[model samples]
Target: MTVADTPQAAAFRRQVLIPLKLRLFLMQKLPMAWLAGLRLRQLTPEQAVVTIRFKFLTQNPFRSIYFACLAMAAEFASGIQAMMHVQAGGPVSMLVVKLEGDFTKKAVGLIAFTCPDGPLIAQAVAESCATGEGRTVVCTSTGVDEAGDVVAIFRLTWSFRAKC
Candidate 1:
């Protein structure tokens, strides 16, 4: 069975699909993301979409969403997928080891960041768990504006290690 079909992954998916549960998760575990108004728009076995809007809390003096906020959304897009995979299997620790971002346009209005690297992340997590060694994968998250224009691209390298 696919990682997403596992009971733990299914449970995590259900928890995230509920807006109130997701909000409470962010409020308790990630206050900055909660304050920045980050929202998870979609989550699937192979993809995740997160959004951030240009609001007072997320905006910068430049009249646009701050770069850090954009990065947070992008990271969440990939991180959520990794989280699902980690939950599907045995205990594993995940962390973002590196992050690189490229801004192609000003981020205004609602920006959606999508990551289509769930399978890749799943493999890494599974390998780490099986081998009891660390594994790393680079997941790319692309951000687009409301008009469908590319706003930013972020490559986040995540490391996973199985726990004893």
Candidate 2:
């Protein structure tokens, strides 16, 4: 069966779809994201969307969202898909080995980060699990403002390794 068809993956999607459940999950596991008001707008096997707003807790001195907060949202856009694949497959460890970001515009209001590399991540996870080796994939997440202007681009390299 495909990774997305797995029961665990379905459960994860369900959990992310429910606002209260997602908030509780974030509160329990990712307190920082919860505090920063990161929200999962969409999630699928092929893509994921996350959003963050510019507020007191997530803004910078320059009156824009902090770069670190933007990175967190970008990472979550890709990381949630990776987590689903990992849970669908056998035991595997995932980590962010590298992160690169390019800011193109001032981020204000609400910013949405979308990552469309879920298939790549799933393949990497499957390869790692099958070969008992580690595999890495670079997932690009793009953040845009409400006007659909590109605000930032983040390339995150995720490594997946099978457990012994």
Question: Which predicted model would earn the best TM-score?
Answer: 1
Please give the CA lDDT of all the candidate structures. Answer: 0.94, 0.94
**TM-score attained by model 1:** 0.97
lDDT agreement of model 2 with the native: 0.94
Q: Cα miss at 132, model 1 (Å)?
A: 0.5
lDDT of 1 by residue, 1-164 (tens): 24446788879999998999999999999999999988999998889999999999988999999999999999999999999999998999999999999999999999999999999999998899899999999999999999999999999999999995
Candidate 2 lDDT over 1-164, as tens digits, reads 23356788889889888999999999999999999999999998889999999999998999999999999999999999999888899999999999999999999999999999988999998899899999999999999999999999999999999995
How do all models score by TM-score? 0.97, 0.96
Cα error of candidate 2 at position 51, Å: 0.3
**In model 1, what is the error at residue 43, expressed in angstroms?**
0.5
Alpha carbon deviation, residue 65, candidate 2 (Å): 0.3
Single out the weakest 10-residue window by summed lDDT for candidate 1: 1-10
